[model samples]
Target: MEKKELVMNCTLALHGCRTSYDRSDLDSWYLLGTYEYDGSKLYLNTLDDKICYCDRYDATPLKSWDSLSAMLTSEIERIFGLFDADGHCIDEDVPTTPVVI
Candidate 1:
């Protein structure tokens, strides 16, 4: 008989297409991903020339969520962000949460 071992690497990411405000750019894709425990990340639309930019912080510890679902659910909000009633962004100094503002 022979001995064998299995190795598993769990990783997940979500992507979607969004149209740019400028008429020349048209549409582009954005990303949000990797397992929460595996250091989840958010790549959003940039303000300047770059299409996308990384929104992760070294000091913040928003990764390592309880489960895969929780990670996905929370990270999605980084795209929408904490919007106010008047459609403005609400900034909070919470490390565990995303801050698009």
Candidate 2:
């Protein structure tokens, strides 16, 4: 995915907040989850009815959203596989799949 594609994916994922007066409101927009790249690291925040998952990665600075999205997607898949229906980790195994944004 390119920058546009990553942006579009994030936008679509945040559709529920499109009508909100403050699109930048983390609480409203991140009801599901959010990802951020801070030059040297990637951060993930996943919120659900039963739990919230927060993680960070000390990764190389991504030059494009393509890389950023790839990392985010991969982390998300890992999170999903690690957790059970109740948001609890099922096992110690971590996911290695590269999910597209």
TM-scores, each model vs. reference: 0.26, 0.29
> What is the C-alpha lDDT profile of model 1 across 1-101, one tens digit per residue?
11111101222244554555564563242354433323545443232222222334542333244443554565545423443444433454433333444
State each model's C-alpha RMSD to the native.
Answer: 16.7, 13.3
lDDT of each: 0.38, 0.36
Best by TM-score: 2
lDDT of 2: 0.36
Per-residue accuracy of model 2 over 1-101 as CA lDDT, tens digit each: 55434442432232132365443555521333334321122222322212222333432222223333664564555545544565544554532222233
